[model samples]
Target chain A: MKAATFLAALALGAVSLAAGAAVAADGPTLAAVKQRGHLMCGGDGTRPGISAPDAKGEWGGFDVDFCRVVAAAIFGDPTKVRFIALTTVQRFPSLQSGEIDVLSRSTTHNLTRDAALGFDFSPITMYAHTALMVHKDLGVKAGKELDGASVCVPPGTSIERNIADFWQQNNIKYKPVVIDNQKELNETYLAHRCDVIANFLPGLATIRAYQAAKPEDHVILPDVLLKEPLAITFRQGDAQWKDIVSWSVYATFEAEEKGLTSKNVDAALKSKDPEIQRLLGVTADLGEKLGLPKDFVYQIVKKVGNYEEIWEKNVGKDAPLKLDRGLNKLWRDGGVLYSPPFQ
Target chain B: MVEAEARRLVPRALSLDNETVRAVVLQVATAAAIVAALYLLGTNAAHNMARQGIVSGFGFLSQEAGYDVGESWIAHSARSTYARTLVVGLLNTLYVSAVAIVLATVLGVLVGIARVSPNWLLRKVSAGYVEIFRNTPLLLQIVFWYTVMRQLPPPRRALQPIEGVFLSNRGFTHPVPTWDPAHGWMLAAAAIGIGAAIAYRRAARRHHERTGRRWPVLWPTAALVVGLPALAWLAGGSPIGLDVPRMRAFNFQGGTTHSPELVALLIALVAYIGAFIGEIVRFGIQAVGSGQREAARALGLRDGHALRLVVLPQALRIIVPPLTSQYLNLVKDSSLAVWIGYPDFVSVTNTAINQTGQAVEGIFLMMLVYLSISLSISLFMNWYNRRIGYRR
Candidate 1:
């Protein structure tokens, strides 16, 4: 009997070691984060209005707040997060390598990524579009007039491929000058090394607002090259972990729909509405199902405000980008965002 | 069987006791261990990539590479395959490196000669050039030149430094004689003329060897080369059409435009590598001793004649070896074009990697191309060095 037990134990141990080499779908990602006591968030270090580091290496932006939301939901402290700066090419690999728990780099949530790249995406964080901007003196009014023009482009992104597709579809020709550094790309475009610059709308806005010699000297064309829905990415196959991350993002959307501002969240906790009570963890065990404290949503909303506050603070009219929320607004407000019931 | 019996008498012939057998077995075992480790690591990577849903293979080479290369010598477009893009990138790399090598050699030789010249002002200036270029990082210099080039006036306000040539931030454009079939015939005539000129020089040398009579070789060679091309041009209707660049809405139309990126990368690479080549050349000329120059002067030769006749011939034997390294370095440095957005081999491969998410294959392909180019350069240089080297 003793010999049989030893042999069975040895076989089990060997099988477990072999299984550990592959990323397991049913593995405990949440437990690993909890044990580490901090969340590792991947971000684009160069995008100003999206997710960039300050002089002191403190990260702050719209996409970065989504990372804070996840951190707050798990540890009840928004500061329990470390940001790993990633380039456009490094973002997916960093997440796949388990070097980061979440990638909130304002990357486009597309079919290739969500279905094919072994990643699950949260609901759209911001509705952006790949766009083209030119020097005001170039007299380029639209994309159709871009023949034989030299364009400055950022390397290692979908925009590199998307811009090519757009030009081919229009049956026009343009020379591409691919610059990897964002600041350098903007400089090259501004110096007239290239006649035009193409990037995401928010990125173009940031460059025009901050990097240009004269803000009025450049104009962004009104052409939607591609509908870019930026979303937070997660390693796929861990359904339990995906649930926690997705709901953390939705909790902020739910808070916005309920008109729960950070200051009013404490006051709303005492409300008699059954749904509000359940959402605030006053009456239900919804948070436990996702393997969290019953008051995870409360922590998230109180620490990082609802979706509108984040957008306004980071890239809205009140911010340097001064972007208008068109398709990024709540579903009831004519936008595409909506959260399921808290129960 | 007799040899095997003799080996067996030397105690444990195949084991550690026998020196030759022990060394061979040790080497084989170590090689096997290294190869086995590499195999394990490769399979582990393949497994991890598969688990992450990354399809790993070179199958993407045949896929349509929907990208544009700014400057290419090859017939390439957005409709081309990834394989064609690699070819375009390789050709651009080869073209730029080849031009940079020739220019840098000329500039370096001049600098080296100036470094040891009789004039004090020339020596100091050449020394300063070497010091400044060699001390700073090449990346910084490339970026500096690019930035300075960007400050040139736009095409509308382009500088007309000379007739029919415009300099601008857009690019430098110059007038060219419009293409005609006559020009093609003229080129072929010039090539044949060159072959005749070389043969005439060899015959003249043989005449000198037999009768000590110096033939007028220069005039004859020049007539054969230049005169033949001129005759071909006249025979083919003497086409004189001029194609000039005119400022269009975005850029100049017609003529040839050298993009600012190409010009800046070439300038920085030549200037930087020229400094190192200058040092090598200075040492080479200095290695030809003053005694040789004195001996030539003792025979009543002029200063220029003595230095050229006595010093350079010997100096060349020393210069050829180190010169090979500078040539190789220039080829490798051309890859830095990616930093300034000049679509060299590594730059386009980076785009391919991004679009396909095939970093491993892309990096491997880049290494293979650079290795091939470097080895070819080494082979040619070695042959040239052997030809110049001394023999008993």
Candidate 2:
């Protein structure tokens, strides 16, 4: 009887071990992040305002800041994040294969992506649109005059489809050159292999800033191809992790609306207002229900700053990109960047 | 006494010396294990995908691709289905493979012969060509070719070394024959002429075998093949016209053009695969014994005749097997055309995967297609090998 019982227990253990591995493979990314002690974020390390590495090999960009925000929320240390630079083609696959905890790449959130890719996207981080950039010598003002011209594009993006649709609808014929790497595409375009370069507006701005021989000689056509919402993506089936990320993004907006900045986070910790107190985790431990420390929002603001600060440092008028926060401003400021109540 | 000895012997099924039974058992065990492993992997992937909420099915193939391919041999649009896009990609892959294989074989044979040439300069140059190409990586060669091609002069100053042909950083443009209704009849005449020429050669061969008298049929066959098409075209008033390319505002217009991507991919595939094929050809020719050449020479065969009749016949027997593998490699390597936007099979599937978020299905389709192509190549080569091999 003892021997039979031992055999039964051993068989049961083996079965349970096999089942546990399968569940663990698709289970909570939160536990995996905690166990790994750092967040692995997928992003393009060359897009200046989005994600780029400094001379010291540390990444500091808007997308990189988002990764830091997630890191701060989980570990209370913004430095506990490792950014894995991925190309346009590699971002989704990297997320699906569980190579990264979150994809902070400037990827658009659309119906196809939301429904098809086994991933969930957080609220819109930025509103992006595709545009064409051509040499001043081309003597063309807009996309309409680019008939029979060659255009360079980065592969595995919506830009390729958008350009095709635009040209076809306008009854113009053009050739497309799909270079897999954005940097290489820019080089090829500058080499006159293509007549025009088509990419997202911010991407084109970054490329022009770094790669062009004379940045002023290039003209960004006033034609917009497609508007999309760029968001942080994580694998689906982990609703808890998705909610955590979503709320974390909301916290940034709520903080921005409350006139909170990284420097003022310490002072806000002592606020008397009930809403501000709950948001800073002073009056309520709301983060516990989301499997985080109650000071998650406080850590986020303290480390990565609010959305306004992030925008100013990375892509605002004073930055190298010098981009206006036209549509990315808070909802009250006549922009689309909005968040639900943190309570 | 014999009966008693037989009865004393162990039964074959129980005996270790039963080789047939043991072999069957081992093979069955291995096959079962392989099947079980495959089943487990498939089920695990399905379960994990389901748990992750990833939709897994071929239904996405019918969805619109919504992307433009750089160059396609078939009719394609932004609204084309993924299945149609895959077909276009497959056709493009075939086109590159077919053209590259023919060009590579021709170049390889010349280089191989040059490598063995008695002239010192010819041999050294051939050796250098082989060493430089085969030693460099194919991807680097492709990128280098593309970069060099991209550095050509702009459209306004496109290099027109020859009249009616334009070369620029954009691409190569030259004259193409404008299609006419009469061209269809011309093609049909050419086909019929080829058929008649083949029949004449067979008849001549039979005549020679029967009467031991040589019939000079080469000129007549060539005349029949060339004359029939010319005659048909003339009868149809020579409607064909040359559509020469001309430089327009931003690009060339009205001519057949080879895109920079296609040119780069072709040059890289030919240069890289040609070198490996050259070595194979050289080894094959060298494998034939010197005695055969001596015997042919003693029989009053000239150098060219001896190589054609005595050496190559033997060399080809060794060359075809490895040559088939190289051809398949070229077909597979054409996928690297994606690096330069050539819209080959893997590239299109990648776009489809990205567009539909159907990575598993797209990958599965690619595997099936590639496997079918590889198997077809293998089967054809095996058939050819059996037909040409020395019959014992």
Candidate 3:
């Protein structure tokens, strides 16, 4: 009787192990996300013009829109995205742990991150420059005037190196008050522990928006300090998923180049040009080849609109950010956002 | 022959030999199985991580950190290696922990004594402080302090209290000393004085032990410490000048200022940990039997002497062990400085991890640092406990 029971228990254990192995062998993250019915995208909750939640708790920004675009492409619904707010410190770990499918959290594409960290970056979404923001009453017009000054910057950011390099090249002496969070940096800057606040230009504009009642009190320096190419990041080793996200971003750029927007996508779908028809998913099996639905690009443009439309709605001249699309413009406009040929 | 046969028959009593050997075999097998399972899990992790093209090594430590820490104790630059950055982080951790320990101990001792006061109001207030701070989470307390500090008035409009001190949301600013190159000897003299004072303290203690007479150790030590440094200052003809923070149109210039985040974090850590230390102290005092205090009172000793000479010496035995743990906890809790943006060990390591993408290396360093701190505290406390324990 004991031998029979032992044999039965062993059989049951083998069955359970087989089941576990079967679950582990499930092929792709995209399919898993589709089955789960929500795209988990990591983003910043406080950065302006990037990803931040509104007072009503709705997530909206350039990064937020990109997450929505991915959701629209995958689930055919822009709202099928859950934004996981992460700090600069938490972003990569959260991505590696599969806590978020993509990290659209103002992550810079660098050699160390790409080669060492095992993150596959998408095409550059926004090219930004580091700038100094100071109180206008300081009479400091440029970075040079702020010699021997104290500056506040967030940690784990490239702003520190940029500021250091600038000081070294200019032979100026300055102190840095480094904090890990933007809120703390702003507080220190406003409190005057720092003579100037160093951050991305878009972030400076966001700070100015919150200080709009006293808009004249702050001035953003005209000097562009560091060039930061921000891109969306995904887990490495999944070439199919990487291509899907990368091309989804490229589709937005292609839509802008073709002047096809949420309003004009339907008309573009009926165009005679094969590339336009294929891009709109009215012709060709591009979506199927990319392991997405036939109308994936159509759904993305229709729901989230083109890259320019999304930027304009969230962070452009009409929005509270009032940012200019300088290098974010289409390739036809002599910008760097050049998408590959659809063929 | 009959006697031998009778002894053999006396007890074939449950020959336990086979059963004992079987149990030993079973236990060994179980242990081996557990170890094997763990090994398999580790090997599987290694295999999967390797398959993903991730490098499994600690060579990243020598690479450039390429990041800046906000409040490093050591000089750091982007050119600094990860090892140096970690050193800066460890120094900052030790710096904050040391300061917090000292502050907590002083505050705790006072409050603990106050908790047992004859005055109802004073006792109740101390008890209330203990209950409130000890019950609330440390993280929330840190956040509250940070918020309050941030809400202070701006720097340009700082509330000036004294001639050179400036107070604002930024931090407390005071006159900082700018030492001339000639004044370097004062620092050297002060270091020498400190060394001499240590030797003097040992001699005084030894003398007191040999002869049951106490020496005026305080005055001589103080003179050695202060007088030598003062003489150096005079001999150097005042080689140091005060650079008071001057409020300009925009911000304060010349003087040093700490960020409010650091001030808030420091304050929160001290206040929160101090309350727990206070409880340990009160219990230590109470643990001294009431009879001892009454007996001391019956003697010619004053109230202060009764408490100091009769009670405190005994009370320390009960208090020191728990007090040591509280100090250890304070050191560990200092990692919470990350919340308020005070760049401590964890914060700097987090930056290195993000910058380099070497999660294993970063996490290992973090674990090792925390473990070393914890072990050192435990070892020191254990030794102190043994020294003060009930020795015959």
Candidate 4:
């Protein structure tokens, strides 16, 4: 018994020493990310046109491409990215604990997440807005008409909370059927369990396109209940890592503005124009300032194309969701998407 | 011989053979070891959480929930605090569990009796119910029932099988009486009637024991309870008014409506727990010997009276213990209501955790709530079991 207790004590002593080392060893996040070899990208795996797995277990979507762009900027290989599917509850905790290097999940960039949670958000990737999707036969055009309507909302989402807020503000009484799983919400909504399904527009559009028998049978209300600026998030203490991620998004937008695609990246690399040459890492030392490879923008363009390509490939006209590039278009294209000058 | 005698008389100065000392040392050492381990783990967690900048405290309970629940027995709004949300969720959990326990007990007793009935069909049906429900998982049953409920017609095309009632995907809506001040008097009359019946039952039992004669208390007790209440209600001008549900633009209004989620959860919980309860009841009833039944019959008592007086009284002793366990199980298992989105204690707390990012406090509160509920149920059932228990 004495020997057993001695051995247990020794083992516990070793465990505590290891735990202390783990807590004390705080290295730069960029260095750690590089050592990990692959960027750990967290996102929603169930959102169809945003980030979801296909039939062959391959994940593809808009946010998935953003992660690949980040990977390409760092390693010059888009495939060197690992996707960590996280729920709303698991997303922030996972990021805070360094389980994932970056969180590109369709999470809103808000004051609470910014100031309180110690997270630094990248530029807005998707300008999302929540709206109510109703059966076209209901003839409801706005939020005010849906008094006493049964609404199906997925739990643990901003959409559910927004529905509550909208109803309270409008003084409209409605029954909310909160399903924890989005898939089940779709099932319940398809079965007409609720009169309306309230969610973000892209999500509603995707669901209507895929889950509905007759896509035209549903109509999204004109009144958007909430504005959601979805962005990429990382732990706050690492400004260098934040700059890398933030500018990675900017490079994609800049590439699109410069009329560059994956096909023309090699051509642009040989260009004589000082601005294009500087962007492609030929004329100036821009990459050194961000602690990335000199040809990071070239790598991003070559591997994942630009913002326009990413959008069109995921949720634009060529995609199944067929969402319009309204506020997401470049500033030159009559929209709000504009990147800071690379200089 | 003298040295041996001194050693024995002196107890050998607290040697291993001293039972009290040995036990005390072993128990204290074990408790100290456990306390040390827990302390280590707790400190480690606190250190890690602090390093990660995750706030650790119970201060978030007073914050506004900024969310709404679908159904609530008490007044609740988005402006309500997180503590109030948890209370609402707890009340919802208790509401479903209490109703389920009563329904399951009644159904289980009846089915259990039917299981051993002379009629072959009834016996087979009862056995089938027990086997099917017991074999399937409770969560799957809950989900299946929810899906079935969702398949009902939409509210615009509600199925009105009877006047003053509607059934649809939205829920079941039926006429409910709008009680006025006169109803209070009627309730008082009913309470008085119940009191008088109880008094007469004791008197009748005493008279039967003293004179070896039966007193007809059943008819008189029934009349006093029902007739008095009806008379008082009429005397108070029959103020109870029916608020029939009327179909509006979207759904039914002006009546008591049971949401489809509630109906689905109730059906699933009752069916699942009723099977286990039925098995317990069958075992308890069977534990009562046939000789007891024959003894009552030999004493010239009818089958109903024999079962009621002799068989049930003995069977109850065996049933109450297991029945208490089943009751507690039912209460704990009601947390599965989250699967069908019933917003029970765990469900609301889960949302709170997700929103606030205070996983530790949310989970701790959930554990405490469930533990307290289980303890309360156990205490009440134990008290009841003791009341009906056999005395030596």
Best by DockQ: 2
How big is the positional error of residue A80 in model 4, measured in Å on the Cα after superposition? 3.5
TM-score of 2: 0.93
Query: Which candidate order results from sorting by lDDT in descending order?
Result: 2, 1, 4, 3
Q: Evaluate every candidate with DockQ and list the scores.
A: 0.34, 0.42, 0.33, 0.42
List the candidate 2 regions with Cα displacement exceeding 4 Å: A1-21, B1-11, B14-17, B207-221
What digit string (tens of lDDT, one per residue) describes model 1 on residues A275-300? Answer: 88999899998999999989998999
lDDT of 2 by residue, B264-334 (tens): 99999999999989999999999999999999999987898799769998999999999999999998899
Q: Who is ahead in lDDT, 2 or 3?
A: 2
Q: Model 3 compared with the native: what TM-score? A: 0.86
Model 3 chain B: lowest-lDDT 10 consecutive positions: B11-20
lDDT of 1 by residue, B1-392 (tens): 99989976887645567768766766665565556555655676677767667777899899998788889997888889999998898998998999999999999999999999999999999999999999999999999999988999988889989887999987789998999999999999999999999999999989989997768887999999999999999999999999988987778888899888899999999999999889988999999988998999998877976876588879988998889888898899999898888889988888888677677778889999999999999999899888877776
Per-prediction TM-score: 0.90, 0.93, 0.86, 0.91
Better of 2 and 4 by DockQ: 2
Q: What is the TM-score of chain A alone in each candidate?
A: 0.91, 0.93, 0.90, 0.93
Error of 4 at A293 (Å): 4.5
